[model samples]
Target: MLQIRKILLRGAGLEDALVQFYSGANVLAGESDTGKSFLLECINFILGAEKLTLVDEAKPYTHLAVEFVNSNDETITLVRPTSGGKVAAYHVPIADISGSGQSIAPTRKGKSKGPDVTSVLLPFAGIKEARLRRNVEGETQRFTIRTIESLFLVDEVAVIDQQSPVTGKATFGDTAQKRALSYILTGVDDESVAAGEKNEIVKARLKAKLELVNEMLQPLNERFASPGELTVLTDDTELDTLIGSLTGELENLATTRDAIQERSQEATRNILKADSQLLGIRELLSRYRLLDERYTSDLDRLDFISEGSFYFDALQEVPCPVCDQIMAPGHSHGPDSTALPIRESAVAEAAKIHAHRTDLAAAIRDLEVRLGSVEGEKHTIDTELKSLNTELSRTLAPRLEFTTERLEQLVNRHTEREATRVERERWQELVKLQNDINSSLAESGTPKQIWAGIPPKELGEFCAEIQAVLSEWKWKGTPHVEFDEKTFDITVDGKPRQSHGKGVRAVLYAALVIGLLRYAAKNHRPHPGLIVIDSPLTSYKKKKNQTVKGENGQIDAGVEAAFWKSLAKTSKDIQVIVIENKEPPTEMAAEVHYQWFAGEEAKADERAGFIPTKSAPAN
Candidate 1:
């Protein structure tokens, strides 16, 4: 049994009354206006109910308080002053389950610790960030408990002696209604993939940026702008080290160019000097050769002229000494003697001079010919040297320049790569940091502190379980429940309707409660502090038994009485307080006995004056 220590009532139109109450089901039976409901209202006031309704003529309660003992025998009293409203409740701590003060604040006491009332009330408020978001998204709806009470309460289920409002456009017979029940039964504070999506987006953006930077950093030919094609490559060594090799190559080219130019210049100068020397030698040699040819011809002519002179001057002459007998002269002499005395010194000197001149001319001619050959050879050498110099300048110089140009390009390209490397490193680091920051991102993109206490996955499972129970009822459509960080969404047949029919809504409402309890049980979670069901058997379908019977059958009760019985059976683990106008199910109410009497203390309705207890309906 759920233990109840005492009940305190003040200004409920009653001056004096009992100071305690019986636990379990406390049935208040009295006259219609004799504080029967006030007793129940008193329980709600201390229970943190926000909405309070009373007749204008009837008086209001000044104060209401209740005491409850826990399993550890510690007592706590929840009190609410009428002026402060039901939401404003104060607590009183006691030593034991009995009415005795002990601790100052029971909830704050360290002994027999439980969850903070804030955490407990956090779910109860249903004003969490998730719920608010859902409400804005138009999923289920936005509501506070106070507003919920204005629409439906246990009083509507206990309709007797009068008919009540069947349904309204925005009544409890809507998807929002079922969700309200879900919230009441189980508090689902948070459930939405907020941080997950944000993290992914951040990662994607980082990757894109890193790729773009890497591509631009690459060498000209291998570069790419497209993010898909760009790939970032990393190397341990820096480009600065490679500069030495290029410098070495440039040095070699410069050296070779200098050496070739020097050799070419030397060859040119040598050829020019040799030509001048040969030219002088050739001039002297030409003069000598001409002299030699003239000398030789003159000698030959002199020999031939001597022979002719002998023939003309000397005629058949023998010896001049024996010419005494013969009168003929051996040789006719014209003004000259045959045996004349010669000028010996003049002849000898002329002969020596002639020989010396002839020899000198021959030697000069030989030297001139040799000098001419040498000069021609020098010309050939000069031409070869000039051609070689031209070849070096035309072919090798351009090649050297080409090498220079290529080296410059290589240097420039490498310089670009170096700069790119530095910048790319920054981008790479940013990408890594972005990844880390995004990893710490929350599930719903909100701060973890706000929703960390909520088990969104479990709440989803609870909704699914409720959907399972609702499957039995044939609604206009299938009913579904969805809760996110913002709000809850309920659908019938996978589609949203403005509202649901009375009978369908009632099924949804029950399913919601069953789902919550089932979830808690399956997960072995703590559930509501208390549950009160008034007329749990009340339904809104058209009465089948009230209609005429068909040809072959009577009627099929849409809801089997066994379902409620099963419900009561399963709800045993929780503190379920039920009051039924009709008999409760056999499974749950089997052992519970209810005694009835028609006497002065019997509960009465407004029509009691017109109808007596014996004439009243069985209910």
Candidate 2:
């Protein structure tokens, strides 16, 4: 499913070398001193690793270049080492790669036409060809790859053999070199990226993440997450806690408010009591004023009578209407009262008595009026105070309590989401781990037949299948090569172990990767369709670690190899490229197109090692 059209290199084992490859399997082989490994480096270079390589004779300043063609007829050219006296790069038309009649001409600064090239022949190289598009004359055009495109390349043997300081078995596959492929996906420029850049990148990414987290929490702070996001029980508990804290303060406030209201009511009650007393005093005052007014009116009448009494001067008994007729004396009788000689003193005394009575009437009326007004004002004040007390006690006070409750509810909602997020994240992780374990078991030769009654998601059933597989294992005498689900452990025979020997471990690892891939594929997860392996097999480095070769272990390897062959055959969509000096299963090899690079054509660093490039065992 994957093909290598060609690879080109400069200044490695060879000053200038290029190789063309078509589909099938290709092998590069050479004796220890030849350029086999150097050619491999060249492949890595052309694919996209950008390290300025130490080439033939250690020409550290040498430039590098590469080219490739894809199945879609797209040609890619790459060149690099441009700076530091290396000035590199140039591109050509696709027609040139197609071997057509058209030729490419180099343009100066601004040009109308551009070239096309984007693929990487290998994954790690020092050259790059990045495609850039520009709008010229209102027309869309694409630029050529001025740098190498990264492709997959493996140099395990050379890596393990290196004695260099930086060559301690890499924790990661050639980092700077592998960056070519990463660039395509991440748009990162290799030259711009430094070893220390990851820390900064991660920090920046985290900063952005934190900002988003803050924003999300801000809205959820208002209890605004969706139904799935907001957990009811969790929310309620959180609400309860928040409410509890606020309720204490609210309760204290309630006490203060109640006391204030009580004082206000008592003031009103006192005012009412004072008003009642004042009302009585006011009634008395009103009667006094009325009596005073009446006294003035009666005094005016008495004054008129006294003036007439002085002018009369007739003898008494002149008009005795009820006594006798024509009686003439110094006395006058009127309205059944007898009057003697008119006297100023008597008139004055009568006026005084009349004024006294009138004054009493006026005072009584004034008191009555004052009392009426006091009663009305007291009634009004009582009503206003009642309204005030009712509003404070019932409306505003209750509203404050309601507001407190709502605030607590909101706080609780946010806390619930925080907890839910933690729980869901953990739950998802556990599920993923459990699934990974089950998947590993399945790939470790645990058969579907043993797990036939179990569904795919049933991890417990899968674990049972694992136990069953172990119990039925043909090579059960050793200790912990088999896995245990109960303890999340592994054992070989009767001995407990976490990992196994290289040969078995390699198979196990392969099983692990494969099983995971299968599980993902079945569950509709995304997976790449290609795998590249370099020096995939080696004789056991430790003799004591070897399992009996003639036993079921050998048989299992055969079956596993067969399984790979079948997978390769059936899953034509996937491509598997494995490099090894050891012979593969003949049956599997027969189904693959294979080639071997012999003589001076193996790795890219061979020529750079200063060995005579021409002095190799000729095929």
Candidate 3:
């Protein structure tokens, strides 16, 4: 088992950033963008990555050093340049690296006239002179440390990607990944497999077929970035159901919008009706007012006639001379002309006009009341129309728009599934062609199987180890884990690991790595004995006002705690380094090597982050 002890990064005129690890379990928890990922990259670089990923915070740093103890308990420290170059291995610790150390090339192909890092580290992990078959022709290549790195060093992206935890991202590397795992589990290498020779014609035909298959598979592989996509293409029931559900929701939203629109239209119509009646009432009131004025004028004229006749009748006869006489007091002014009778008739006419005026005034008052009531009704209708319009625009319309968008997404997914189905068929054809090539090669010569599958008893034991790991972590389901040889991945409860959500995938991937370590330790199998995981608990952390649920439809309240406790109880023979953003449970603080990057300037014993913001105090 290779246990990491300490890592240091320093440059001239800059503060040295240092992190130390312990034997059992180590955790580096911090905020994001604070060089936690950079630290992982630095480790990979030291292990044998051709290039170190450059980050802005690490720009000033030029050298990195990692100290670890191999399975033999021999302390070894390796120092390499961050700018890329050969690595210097010191049989002693990092503090003594300046004395005497072996200079090893960073890569296997480097012309540095020194041993490569792979050759040096392989023996340290109890693996020496291992080889893996590169192709179906049984041609072998040296299995370097990089071949097994993914199993133990899981980064953030790899932890949640839908690819097999063993198979990694590259489709072409699937065979290599499987062979690497087999080598670890079974203590076997592919060097004993014999390479086959083919005649020129056979080789030419095989080459053509291989090229054709690769040409067809390239686009399919690129289109389906992950195996999960191909899995999705196999069944359309879930997608179809989702599409149906979205369609139903969209229809329901449309119905609601239509209903609101209908109500709005009705309110508008009622408003218009009330407005028309109000207008009619107003016009009628105007005409009635005019008639009332005419009645008043008639009454005034009648009054004047009545008063003038009364005064004339009251006049006494003065002179009887010719026409000047006052008609001799009711004598021959006209036929029986008495001013009293005229006055009485005029007064009666005035009273009739007055009564008509009173009736007209009452009618005007009634019309005014009706006009007010109609106006009130119009106002009420207008208010209702405004409210309906608001609801249609603000509530129903937005909801309808959202549902339409969701339905469109489902439709697009359905279309993508169709395209994937075609690609899947093409992939099948490619597989058949490859199998035919393999058959032709087999018929030509007897080639030893490069990698016989893992023994069933061993595989069963490995699966049980994984189940135990998950059980210890308080995994949501009754985990029945099986290593799927067909997919080169694990299945939990008969479901492929990729089928679960990303959080579950991450947790399951973590379990696989840890379980492998535990299994190797228990069975005395060869393993690196060191595991570094990043962000394994990110999706398990509860955010503000949110309750996180796992795959079993239960709140994951205890999963994170269980994860920490399990790691804390990991065997002392193995070293587990977990990089996370959330804090661990307080109870397990004493059990694990807790390295906290406070993500701020240090106060007292706290750290700022993986990248120091200031120089360390002189001792």
For lDDT, the strongest prediction is: 3
How far residue 295's Cα lies from its native spot in candidate 1, in Å, is 99
Best candidate according to TM-score: 3
Q: TM-score of predicted model 2?
A: 0.32
Sort all candidates by lDDT, best to worst. Answer: 3, 1, 2
Instruction: Write candidate 3's Cα lDDT for 529-560 as tens digits.
Output: 88999988775444336443334222266877
Over the full model, what C-alpha lDDT does candidate 3 score relative to the true structure?
Answer: 0.79
Q: How accurate is candidate 2 locally (lDDT)?
A: 0.42
Per candidate, the number of residue pairs that clash is 14, 95, 0
Misplaced by over 4 Å in model 1 are 1-8, 11-44, 47-51, 55-61, 69-74, 83-460, 467-500, 524-527, 533-536, 539-560, 585-619
Off by over 4 Å in 2: 1-3, 9-18, 23-36, 47-65, 79-152, 157-498, 504-531, 539-560, 563-576, 585-587, 597-614, 617-619
**Candidate 2 per-residue C-alpha lDDT over 312-368 given as tens digits, one digit per residue, 9 for 90 to 100:** 444454546667665554324442233333445657677677767766766666667
In the range 81-168, model 1's lDDT, one tens digit per residue, is: 5544322222343222233322221132334344333323324322342231233223333433322332233332322211111112
Considering TM-score, which of the candidate structures 2 and 3 is the better prediction for this target? Answer: 3
What Cα-based lDDT does every candidate model obtain? 0.45, 0.42, 0.79
